[model samples]
Target: MCVLIKKYKHINTNNYNVLENALTYDIQRIENDLKKNHNSDYFLIINDEGRLGKMRKIQRINYIPSIIFLSEIELLIEDSLPKASKNSRFIQILDTISYIVYLYCLEHFNNSRWANRVRNKLNFEDVINLLDKIKNNSNIQASRTNSYGIVHYPR
Candidate 1:
């Protein structure tokens, strides 16, 4: 006989059903308690000792999959660059990466909830404007560096 069936064989049907429900309820209650005490997020769990070992374990499990997804998006951006005059695809990818970073920040840091609020307030046009400013600054910096005859070494 199955272990569960053998263990519950002495209980009447109604009592068995009640026992099952109680067990489920107790499990959920325990989980809620743990979450409340630990300040755990969807992807991370921090214990009372303030160790992030469990969070690192969870991140390690999903790291490869996240990298693969990011690489695919990078390939899409590279392909779109040749055919589209507007770098909308690149901007979209940048926005997605920013959102992912924002989510990570929210999950990992207790005080970073403001980042989520700021990210929610930003729109596509805001992202595009930020990108334009970044490109202009980079161009100006490059010209200044060139004028100074400074060679940047790859680290």
Candidate 2:
């Protein structure tokens, strides 16, 4: 499944009309293409539209960092379970971003062995670093490539 998560600040919703409009457009395009190609992939959109109460608790208590730290530990957890006990949503997002980074590198450096290097060096710290790098690069490239989207239009 391909989940596209948009994590905007909870209170910034009202000011994100343009972002919402662009998200709708991209989601529609993804859905249409998935349908047309008969792909099993799925797209999901997650926003902080109605989670103010939860956000407030985390915000006021400074619990967000602990939650994130727990997330990292979950990714490192091991068991006889069906899959990693990590935050499923976060794992899924990380996987998707990692795949995108590999794809980008494959396309950009046809002869380089960066993918193999990344796979071999995939440790907890390195993986976190890799994810951050990929997320940053993906955001940059996505914004640059999607320049013609509705959000870029002057209202």
In candidate 2, position 128 carries an lDDT of 46
What's the lDDT of the predicted structure labeled candidate 2? 0.38
Using lDDT, give the best candidate's number. Answer: 2
Residue 120 CA displacement from its true place in model 2, Å: 21
For candidate 2, lDDT tens digit of each residue in 66-153? 2124211111112112234144676566556646544433333343345576558554455346555655333333233332111222
Please report how far candidate 1 places residue 100 from its true position, in Å. 2.4
Q: Rate the local accuracy (lDDT) of all candidates.
A: 0.32, 0.38
Q: Which residue runs of candidate 2 sit more than 4 Å off their true CA positions?
A: 1-16, 39-86, 89-155
Pull out the clashing pairs in model 2. Answer: none
Where does model 1 exceed 4 Å of error? 1-86, 115-155
What are the candidates' C-alpha RMSDs?
25.2, 15.4
Which RMSD does model 1 reach against the true structure? Answer: 25.2
